[model samples]
Structures are given as structure tokens and as C-alpha cells.
Target: MRCAARRCAGRRRRRRARGGRWRRPRRRARAEEGRGLVRGSSTPVRGAVLLYGLLAVGAVTWVLADRGTIDLWRHPEPLWRFPFAAGLAGGLVVGVVFGRIVAWLSRWAVRRTRWGAGLHEEFHALLGPLPDSDILLLAFLSAAAEECFFRGALQPTVGLVAASLMFGGMHLPVNKRFIVWTIEATVLGFALGALFWAGGQLAAPVAAHFTINYENLHFVRRYRPA
Candidate 1:
């Protein structure tokens, strides 16, 4: 959010991460109150909630309807299995790695093309108003719901390529943006799909997805182009 500057500076000076609830500097808090900038609802947050809720519900319904095909956890291997634990651990590693790569890509894109710069601007414009908590919550919600629908429900039915393509397509921006966004998302879909297919479970993909979302959101929020 645009408040990244204030938030970052405040964080530098503040003592904590709102042990119970989020807080800001006394002066900044009063300033925001005066400007009527603090509120409980906004267009971006509401729209994301509705969209992600639908994706989650649809994924659940589809999975339930076609459980014969969609495998949530590895078969024959119990939840306590070592391989399953390893898969989740591996996914988390992959997620952190990918998140960093994408953040680098963001910087490169901004320097290379107008489309990239536009995408970066739009990214900030859309997310700039949100606080850290909402960003994390939405990132988790979107990643889980998306992985459920794409990797969990669809991959089994349509195979990996198709599911990955659909996943990338789902993220196309309404306005112009760098094509690399879709390209990267498609690649990510492929990676996630492969993760699901190999593990024969949802745990790895979900873990990886959440980590990537969390890491990337924080990176982009703070990142500034020179």
C-alpha cells in the first residue's frame, strides 16, 4: 500500500507487531482519522473476498462431486507418513525459492517494458490501501482456493497442461499488463500441478502456494523501482 512508507518508518520506530491488534504511530493514527482514511471496508478488499470465496466454494463443490478423481491426500499412505511430511517440507522450500524468483522478475519487468511498469503500478494501486493483515489473509485465501480448484479439482480431470493453462488464464488482468504475469503464473501452475500429481495429495501444493503468496505479497508491497 502507499502507506508502505509510513508503515515501514513506523515499524522502524515501533516496539511491536500489534501483539493483539494492528496499531500505528499516535500522530499518524490521528492524521488518518482526521483525513477519514481509516475504514473497515473498501472496493478491493470486498471484491477479493467475494471472488476468493466463490473460488473456494466452487473448488469444494467440485471436489465433493468428483472425489473419485480428485485425491486430497496420498492414498495408501497415512497422514502420518514420512514421505508426506517430506513433500510438505519440499513444497515450502520450493515456495520460498519461487517467491524470490518472482520478486526478481518483478524488478526486471519494471525495467524492461512499459507493460511491466504498468503491471507494477496497477499492483500497487490495487493493493496499496490494504494493511499487512489483510494482505496475508487474502494471499492465503487466494492461494488455497486457487490450488484447490486448479491443482486439486481440475488437474485430475483435465490433466496437468490444461489445468495449468486454465490457472494462468484465470489471472489475466482486465487492463493491459505484462504478458509475463500470465506466463509466470502458468509456469507456477505447472509446478504446482506437478507437485500435486507427484505427491498424489494437496498438502504440498497448499503449503507451497501459501508460502509463495505470503512471500511475494510482502516483497511487492515494500519493493520500489529505482
Candidate 2:
């Protein structure tokens, strides 16, 4: 009877020890999951705040700059009558074509070269896991604010070349992708500037910008690696 009691006590002790070992790992895993959830939730908030902040700043700057020079409500018709409907249709077509070409080139480059793949991955990381809705909003707001400031305000004052250069330069940051991004931005700036110049109104460039951004955002979100 004494021997049986002693064995039973030993078994109980061993079981408790085994249970404790399993419980510790389970607790650690739960803590890690909680941390991941917090990070995932916070990232979108930060991205939205940054995008909206840019929109607000751009809007204020445009308002201040164009106070008397360019009336948002009125513009003298160009000698060549580029109707608003025609401009909108043209902008949409051009924007879609341009966006498709850019996306195809980017994807091709990513598949072809290690450097391109690395850049693609880096950009994906930078964008994070933004939802489709947030991405759409960001693209639209960015297009509107940037077009208002660059095409609506700055281009008229500084001329197309200067405005486009400034637009390109604005993208330069102390990063590995700065030069590439700057060049791409410069080219895009020129295209948008030309559209603005041709249409003689903010509508064309704004539509084009929005279209390009929206398409690109969707492409990146859909094709980015898991």
C-alpha cells in the first residue's frame, strides 16, 4: 500500500511538469499572435493618416497660391475648343493605356532581373498590407491634391518644363530607389503636364492621374508576392 501511494504521487508530479511545459509554449504563441494583430491594425491607421495629411497640405497650398491668379470656378476658353467631355474621354483612354504599359513593364522587369525583383519586393514592403478601399482612397486623394497643386497652380506659373522638373525632384529621397523613382516621376510629370497644357483645364490631368494611380494600385495589390 505504501509503495502504491508513492508511485501515484510520482506520476502526478510528472504529469504536472509535462502540462506546464506545453502551457508555456501555448502562452508564448498567444502573446506573439496578439502582437501581430496590434501591428496589423496600426499599419493601416498610419498609412491613412499620412495620405490624408498630404492631401490637406496640398489643398491648402493650392488655395493659397491660386487665390487671385487662377479661379477654380472660371477659365477663359482656349482658342482651340477642346470640349470638357472630349478631354475627359481622351484622358481616360491615355491613362488606361499608360497604366497598363507601366504595369506590364514593371512585372516583366521583376521577372527578368534580380535587381528589379528586389525593388518590387521593397516597394511591396513599403506599401504594406493596405486594403483595396484604402488603396483606392489614397490613389484618388493623391491624384486630386497633386494635380490641383502641380497642374492647377504651379504649372501655370513656372511653365511645363520647370513644373515637371520640380515635380520629379519632389520624389527624390535618400533611398536606393530614389533615382529610378525620380526619373519615372519626371516622365509621368511631363505626360500629365502635356495633358494639362492640351486641355487648358485641370480636369484632364486630374482624371489621367487618378486613372493611372488607381490601376497601378490595383495591379500591385493583386500581384504582390505572398
Candidate 3:
């Protein structure tokens, strides 16, 4: 009788999931979008287009304005050393450590502050509908494109402070409680700038940024449903 009861419950749960319980969170996120609490259209296709468009712009800007040179670094190298292999390895390590730090801080915020919890929910709502594959793609693209544009092309043109400020402004808050994201991004931009300056190439900042995004976005995808 107990075994039969367990089977019945499992069947009922599957039925409920099929009945849309599994998609409730996504629907709720869409509803929030309707209400204007969420920003931007969050579809995977749109996201890809936007990222690629930025990448093209970066490439063009890099060719024209910067004259294809990177004198902004503390020790600028010949463009022949494009990969910067050592910096990539070191930046990967730094990215992992920084990701853990940010994760710890985010958890603390969610647990300790009411606003933090709400902001967390807000991100979920905005990002809930993405498939796991899309999360990975977006993570890589966003990191690569952002680092290319901000650290690679723009920094050499405008200098660190100006470039970092623009990067921060690009991630401005969605709401009052979400100001923390903007501040965090700004600090991260500067850190990435330092990495660029030290490593003397775009590879380090791109690798580090990619690691951080992969960590955080995968975490978001794996978050327990509320």
C-alpha cells in the first residue's frame, strides 16, 4: 500500500508539472516584464544579436580610433603577441577567486537584507526563461564582447578612469536596491582594467570576465525555485 501511494504521488507531481507548475516562474517573470519592473527583452535570440552587434562595433572602433595599438598597458607589447598565454592562465585563477568572493557577498546580501532578496527575485524573473545552453552562450559572449569593447578598444582611447566609469554606467541599477550591482560592476571594471594594464593584452581580462560570468550565470540557472 505504501509503495502504491508513492507511485500515485509521483504521477500526480508529474501531472502538475505538465500542467504548468514547472513554468510558473517563467510566466511570473513575463508578467513582471509587462508591469515594467524588468528591463530589456530577455529572449536568447535577441540577446545574441545585441552581443554580436556590440562585437562588430568594437572591432570597427578598434581598427579606426586606436590605430591597432595598445600603448595603454604598463608594458605594451607587439601585436604579434595576441594570445598572451601567461596572462590568460593567471587571469583564469584570479577570476575563479573573485567569483567565489562575489558569490559569498551575494549570498550574505540575500540572507541579511530584505531589498537584497527582492533584487535577487528580480533577476530570476528577468533571466528565468533561458535554457541552460543559452546561459552558457550568453555568459561567454557577454564577457568576450564587453571586455573587447570596454577594456580592449575603449580603454586605450579614453584611459582607465574614463573607461571604467563608462563600463559602470553601462550597468546602471534597475532599482534602488539593485544599485549594488552597478557599484560591483564598476569595481570589477577597474579590476579588469588593472588586469589589462598588467597583463598587457585583452586576453587576460576576457578570460577573467568570462570566468566570472560563467560562475554567476550558472549559479542563477541552478538556483532553487522560489
User: Which order, best to worst by lDDT?
Assistant: 1, 3, 2
Q: CA lDDT of 39 in candidate 2?
A: 37
Judged by whole-model lDDT over C-alpha atoms, candidate 3 comes out at 0.68
Q: Candidate 2 has what TM-score? A: 0.67
* Number of colliding residue pairs in each model: 1, 0, 0
Candidate 2 total steric clashes:
0
Question: In candidate 1, how many Å is residue 170 off?
Answer: 1.1
Highest TM-score scorer? 1
lDDT of 2 by residue, 1-226 (tens): 9999999999999999999999999998665444422233347545555765675576556656656543531123332456678766766676666656665776776677665666667666667555655566666777777777666667766778998998888777457854666787898899878777766666666666776667766666566543
TM-score of candidate 1 versus the correct structure, residues matched by position: 0.71
Tens digits of per-residue lDDT, candidate 1, 1-226, equal: 7799988889866646563245447767765434312245457766777888898788778767877444544423333344657767775666666556655765777778777777777777776745666666777787788888887777776778999999999888566564667887898899878767766567667777777677656656776555
Ranking by TM-score: 1, 3, 2
For each candidate, C-alpha RMSD in Å? Answer: 11.6, 6.8, 8.3
Q: State in Å the error of residue 198, model 1.
A: 2.3
TM-score of each: 0.71, 0.67, 0.68
Worst 10 residues of 2 by lDDT: 70-79
